[model samples]
Target: MPREGLEVENLHLWRGEHHVLRGVGFALPRGGCLHVTGPNGAGKTSLLRAACGLLYPESGRLLWDGRDVHEDLPTFHSVLMYIGHEAPLKADLSARENLRYWIGTRRRIGRDTLGAALQRVGATAWSERPARTLSAGQRRRVALAALSLLLVPLWLLDEPTTNLDAEGQQLVGTLIEEHLARGGLVLAATHHELPLPRSRVQRLELTHE
Candidate 1:
């Protein structure tokens, strides 16, 4: 497997007429996790989106394996998994159904693997429940379960623990740890403290321009 490494150089973005990210740069190697922190109106979210090719930078560039991500978007996206604040689930679909839908888009997964994923995220009990009927935390778990179903090397997460309680928060930490242990890279924007060990984690703080 290729070692996933991400580099952002002098990134600058504008949201409307206001500048969001200003000369932002960072590098994350395989098995590393970067925690992005800042107050509201700061450019943390913008930075994550730019890094994942969701938003284009006005200047500078994002590189995966030292090549511009925009140069080959499909290859970059194939190894990247991004989960923002909203749970990207269909209201009418059951949690299992949603997972199956997303998994199908990437690769085939067996019933056992799906079950294990749900179990790992503590969403097994409500796996058959419609997403709309689940609580915020439950829905978030359903989204997190998708992580277990796939092995993407880079994860760009925005407020991953948004609606979770203590246990759910712990689950997120465990998942990050497991991913890092397997040499996956993570860049997360969060207001809350994540439970990752400092050795494998780095911090990046953003300020509003």
Candidate 2:
């Protein structure tokens, strides 16, 4: 598979009456990572949402491989994965159950594959525990396990290191590094520094006006 590219052009966004993003633009090539940094209310989350078609920008375009993302919703979504601040998992479901539910049988991932993903995030020991019974950090780890099962080219992550301990944080960094090595792209909004190589990393700092 060829590495994908993402381009954001003149992006302008608003939150009700407030203008959050103004003319933000950047390009991420294959095997690249972009870290979005800023203080509170700087539209870092909004930019990620817009890039993945979650929120519509007032103006500008999001392009994937030189074509507008909106032009082909299915193709765009199939190639991208978005992980927001919330760990989108079912509290009543066990860690393994949650993965099975999210990935579904259509993808043909076996139990061993799911277990391996949990192990990668150090959640294998707690795979049978309900998400609600897990600590905040453990829940985050379960959510991150989806990254291993989904073989998408683009990743949009918001606050990926939230509630993680030192080892957990290091695990996330290592996973991201491996993803980049395989010709994947990542755009993350985070306050802490990640383990991305300097040569493959780009920075976008949002400012509130």
Candidate 3:
């Protein structure tokens, strides 16, 4: 039988002359969460990008259920979602329209579903406002709302709590817990500690080498 969940083995990445990841490896089963924490330039974001196939590594393999992800990139991507350091919303678009466009790329979503996702992340109040007019925290909320709309199994988030107050941060924790409860896997790279239960989170601290 195949091993369940995500596994990274002997990952090595280079950006020009600089080596970012140095043979990193880990295994995360269903309902698992991995928190990657480190200083800036520790390759935290790089690892997430690599895992989700946005950036390929010089040497390594990402396995889902004991099979190589590169074998079928499209199929692997269908089950993966990656949210980078910057929110991907369009500056000219309203929050609602942004979700519709973003979520529409992966799957079709209705207005009611978009509204519910925004409401879940506490961004429904300004869902009609232009993305440029929203505050950083509000934009982050919109990003989370987009995340909620996706039903993928693996989530790769970079600095998920970058611009949020205490309540908003807790909201992220709640959403993550709910996702994990549904047998989803989350790997988040953040500078500050996430407001999640320690028991459900497995931490990986990266360092400058």
Report the number of the highest-TM-score candidate: 3
Cα RMSD for candidates in order: 1.8, 2.0, 0.8
Instruction: Give the 10-residue window scoring lowest on summed lDDT in candidate 2.
Output: 102-111
Ranking by lDDT: 3, 1, 2
Where is model 2 more than 4 Å wrong at Cα?
Answer: 1-4
lDDT of 2 by residue, 46-86 (tens): 99999999898999989898889998987898898898898
Clash pairs detected, candidate 3: none
What would the per-residue lDDT of candidate 1 be over residues 147-174, giving only the tens digit for each residue?
A: 7678999999999999899989888899
| Candidate 1, number of clashes | 0
Off by over 4 Å in 3: none
Candidate 1: the clashing residue pairs are none
Task: Kindly give the stretch of ten consecutive residues in candidate 1 with the minimal lDDT sum.
Answer: 1-10
Q: Going through the candidates in order, what is the number of backbone clashes in each?
A: 0, 0, 0
**Residue 66 shift from truth in candidate 2, angstroms:** 0.6
lDDT of each: 0.89, 0.88, 0.92
